[model samples]
Target: MSAIMKKAWGYRYWVLVILWLVYIINYFDRMAVLTFLPFIQKDLHLTPVEVGQLASVFFFAYAAAQISAGFLADKIGSKRVMYIAITVFTFVTALTGVVKNFGQFIALRIGLGLGEGHHFAPAIRAINNWFPFKERGRAVSFFATSWAVAPAIVPVIVTSISVSFFGGAWRPVFYVLAIPGAIGIFLLWRFISDSPKEMIAKGKLSKDQDIEEENVAPKKLSKEEKRKAYGVFLKDANFYVFTLCLFCQLAVYWGTSTWLTSFLVTQHGLNIKEMGFFASAPYIVAFFAMMLGGWLMDNVVHRMKPVALIGYIGSIPVLWMLGSVEKGNTGLLLTLLLLVGFFVNLNFGSIYAYLPKRYPKEIVGSATGLANGIGQLGSFISPLIAGYLVTVGANGSQDFSRVFIFFAIVSAVAALCAVILKEKKVTKVPANTIGSEKSVS
Candidate 1:
């Protein structure tokens, strides 16, 4: 083997580290807004319903963009899609600081959603390119840690800056948060390739070395062939079940993430700083929960449905306990909320890992995109429903009891959907199948 190839082989894991960092910044930009919502609501004189509408609008645009983004990733390559998405969202997030009215705020948020929506499918494809199947659950879960880490850290960062440095102004926080994304774009552009084949072609790795032997790259397909493959996905019953399961899971997850701080502030009477601290408690537990769940999925049980079922079923009672806790019981409240976070996030990595595993590499991006896009409807609707529920309470006070119960019911539905999801054995396709216009079966 050439010296350069040996070096490249040693450096393969570094690609995962870079992707992990990008994932962190991806979520940091998204979740930072959650922490800033109270400040934004006050500054714009918006009602709780309006605040919820803003979040819902972002998810709507995000959902709408997913399928197209997936198609684009499959066509142009995940590396290119990820780079463009990172650049677009970072610019939009910085522009968020300059919006003056609700109209402009909504427009910029939609733009941010469009950009951010392209990120995940491409990231999943990239992981599939870099890691073997057996290790993918752990790798993806490690990447998924950004979900927990972002929420845990962004609250403290945004709250500290908004209160201390910006003197309660939230605009500058958005502006400053865009910086990491800018750096991420540069790193991804310089370091990332679409697949190991690209690296080998570029003389970065040896042709003889079988770094990814277990997960061979799929042959490129013609446009007609691509359409036929997607048609097969449309006809698959398991696809709908998996997508529906994700929809239910995300509905409960996004609803809680979007409104948890607001719930604490208005319902529990906690101040912004106190709210930030308390809100972070659950995600801290979630970080460990996600890691443990991923480890178990990769090492012990290979099926995602059972793990996801546990997360959803276990979350129901914890969510109820969260809703029932009295205002002054800080310790008990935090404990219940922590469990809620743990259970809700337990399947984060496994679900994404499961998607690509079920589909051939040629259509994995499409499958991921379609599932995530349809799943985002849950995120798009749940916050809006919760807002309406909270808004209808007496004398402008929000009744979170009803909202919590609603999420519990949603969790139950998600758990049931999980029970219905069956794992499919992936079949190998012949090289001759790549150019054929016939539907994949």
Candidate 2:
């Protein structure tokens, strides 16, 4: 191997690390609001329904933007899309501190959602660009852990800042969180490239054995061919199944994550400081769970469907237990919540690994975006439904039984969808024939 090739290989893992950092900031900005909800509620005199609407508005905008972002990433490049998204979202996150009323808060949430909505697909596309097929699951899972890590850390950080630095003021917490994201904009711009081809073209890498072997260029497709590929994706039954499975999983995920802190405070009688600390427990467990899930997918199972099936099925009982546990049984509740976290996230790496691999590189971003976009509708609706279910009674208490049942049912459906999902087998045709052909069971 030439010196350039060796250096590029050495730097490949750093790319994953950088993206991981970006994801941490991405989720930190997204989830810090949840920790601040109680303060925001008091400050703005907003009802639970309206608070739920704030989260819903973000998801609505987020879901709406995914397809366009994915298409744009594929057409232009992931690097550009990611840089623009991080910058826009960082600015929006800083502006989150400035909203004084419900309308202003909702508008800022919408803007934040629009900015962040573009992040996932492009990040996945970048993973596809960097890692080999066999290693992608582990790489993607490592990236996915930001979901757990951000929540685990952000709640503590935001809550601490709210209590200490801002005297329980939530706005300054937003401003503090936005700074790291602003810094990330420069790091990404300086370090990231769309593909190894760009590096080679720019003479950052030479045509050497190690680099050449790892950086095989993807097959090019004409515009008509690309359109046909998208049509095939739409017509395929597996696409619907996968997308629905993702939708159900996200429903369970966002439903629980969005409301768990409030539930702890209201239902379990934990104070804000206690809620912040305990709220992190589940995701703390989930951090390791997701890492284990990723490693298993890459090394042990080596298939997406069965891993997802097991995860969704396993989560049902735990979620039911979480819902049924007696109020004030904080110990049991936290345990069940942790188990639910573990099971629910087992599919994180597998889903990301599966979707991009199933489609042509030319449309991988589109397929990923479509699945995530449609799936995020679950994120949009689940919180709203939960809010409606947990209606504040005359005594100012909520009955959480119905909400728990809803999440359990959603998880059960996700497991069923996983069971029915058919993985496509791709066969390379002759070099002179069309680019590739895929057959689905």
Candidate 3:
């Protein structure tokens, strides 16, 4: 390869590209279960409540593991942590096909969650390490789009496999989707470097070039320093507010995404194919909104603490309308879902930008893990609640109306919380390890 091309695909860009691809596979494997849920429900003779419990298995494991994963990422290298995580989940997800009963199915899903739990906590840490302060928002926002895109494409792909290639066997769909994930493991193993120091050494690049390449100052922390870093973050009220806001956001976000497909089929008379297309539309809107939100949030950070509060508050009406719209008016329902998905996702970018902007780099990963971990609990609860509501109202009546209202109220509360978050100036960034370079008053 020419030097120009080699420089273009240098270690920095290569790491980012491969990690992004890994994230895409991460989301695809995790969300494959949702699209397959209706079939799983029928085949397993499970009730709606039982299905909700099964789905909750993923979140239970995910939420429970975040802190430990964050701690591990801080101790071990994030790349090694991620590699182990991806391998664990990929194997378990493939094995999900072989389960013969609900008990075994739930067990496998829980294991899937445990394996996948290590991803966002450490991946966010990796991004925070690699990207500069100004560019981190866009970097995080772009990766966050995996949540949007995987659901959009994976459903169609998995549905096709489930229907035709597998002779309508959901088990075969699980097995097939696991193939690409295994390939991702090999890619990560070959290309992923743990830190900029390692990347520079392995690639035979100058230390100065590596620092300039990633726009990061080389900072190494000891165990005590890492502990104190997290300690500082834990004592900050701003972190608490961000965590609470994220928790509420998760409730509404997952509540809608998890159930929207089934809602279309049961209440709006959408067939499986139609439901797949429509379900993907909102996340498509969300993809653009997240990108836009990240850009706008950074531009206006000094002036507006609640940069995406409008989007969050605005979603209440949109979500309420989503569940209240007429069954025959698919256009109107689609509009509501699309807007809700857009604004709800916009909050994701805004919150990520907001947090790191206000906090120092030393504890960015730990704070983010705590917030995102707490948020995962909301993810755990929302779908299970929706499932119970649907099960009890299963006499063909749309009971999800009240559920939608609940999320609207929860989102409104999130907006209010967003307003109260005090944005502090991140005064100093230490060069190597954590110490009192400059003090914050």
Candidate 4:
């Protein structure tokens, strides 16, 4: 094996493993609320619209916080920012149990969003620092697997916890979940260093140490110049197009996943437990699809380019078919939903892999944060909109048919936008250009 490959399979592999676990917890905490939504709704005596709004408040804060977090991650180091963010998130997640009213609930959800929002931009930056460009797709995808794993495992855990410890009460479920996060914070403090300089100096040096230090050493940029550069990134056509693509994708995926369990229970007449099992089926399929997709994107396709478009366009018809399925067709519904999960998550690693390839390292976190912030707004809005549609249906009916059709249309639009995404061959970072930490500046 090559030297890098040999190293990758050793201690560096452990680094990747740790990063993935951190992300798993990150996603677990973020999504644990969703799995418990039904219980929360019932306990609070909330209507469908209120439930949706509560769910959305987290995303609203998450989306807004990502922008500033991106900039802050660069100003400080990703490691420190992540350490603080994770601790804050864990505490807030635990505190969610204590909420007595809608206002308190809303405040806690917003805090959850803001705390969790910092994880992605910084995590991606750390991945770029740890792995070389050639291996990034697979490396990053390995981390991105948290999305699939979260839905697959977290719901099951939350269900068990609710049944066993919380006596089916959603409030104490949050408290129990927060205990491990305390340990997670300590591990982050002990192991994760911002860059290789810290890594090597801390006696953890390995190969490529020089390259990592070169990447992290501070540079200087004037305030006015930083503003001009941020302006350039914001005004770029390709950036906006990519943002819209993610927006559509998140809208469709979140809309479907957020409501899938409820849909199965209400429309198909399945019990809550059955709905949980059905909801988990897609994430199971997604796990294999993501692993295989990452391998294919890296080992075979190697274009590292437009393969994301294929994943997007291919999902349109699948989602359409999923929407068109009749309520009684359990076999067909499960099959198609599985495929939807696979294809939707298939492109996830590819989309994130595109950012570090296209942007200069200096601004990659900001650019990623910008894209994620814009895309995550869809996460904020999709649930709210879907709930409104269902609530406003004839005679308080919760028919998700129209919502499904809208999601299908959005998927197609995303495919069209993905087709227009520019693929730059190289990133040009001018030598000796010093600027402020551009986390948000």
Candidates in order, TM-scores: namely: 0.91, 0.92, 0.90, 0.89
Ranked by lDDT, top first: 1, 2, 4, 3
The segments of candidate 1 whose C-alpha lies over 4 angstroms from its true place after superposition are 1-10, 162-165, 206-210, 214-216, 391-396, 430-441
The collision pairs in model 1 are: none
Q: On residues 1-441, what C-alpha lDDT tens digit does candidate 2 reach at each position?
A: 346433555556777889999988888888787767777889899996788678789999999888888888888788899888998899888888887899999988988888899998999988888777667788888899988888788777777778998788888888887789877887787777777777667766554444534344456667766666676577777889999999998999989988787788787788867887777788888877777777887788777877898788888888877766787788898788878888988888778888765765666788888889999999988988887787577998866777888898999999889889877643332234333555532
Report residue 162 deviation for candidate 2 (angstroms): 4.2
lDDT of each: 0.81, 0.80, 0.74, 0.74
Structure candidate 4, residue pairs in collision: 71-439, 71-440, 220-434, 220-435, 221-434, 221-435
Off by over 4 Å in 2: 1-6, 162-164, 206-208, 211-214, 217-220, 391-394, 427-441
- In TM-score terms, candidate 4 sits at 0.89
Error of 1 at 256 (Å): 0.7
Look at candidate 3 and tell me the lDDT of residue 225.
65
- lDDT per residue for candidate 3 within 1-441, as digits (tens), equals 335323422555566667778888988777788777777788889986687788887898988777777767766767778888898889988897887778988888888888888887778777766666666677677777777777778877787777887787888877877788888889877766665656656774335433544445236676666666665667777678877788888888888888887788877888967887788888899889877777776556532245558778788899888877888998898788788878788867667766565555556666677778887899988877766565334475555777787888888888888788776655444445333323212
Name the regions of candidate 4 deviating beyond 4 angstroms: 1-9, 207-232, 391-397, 431-441
**RMSD per prediction, one decimal?**
3.5, 2.9, 3.2, 4.4
In Å, residue 319's CA in model 2 sits off its true spot by 0.7
TM-score, model 2 to reference: 0.92
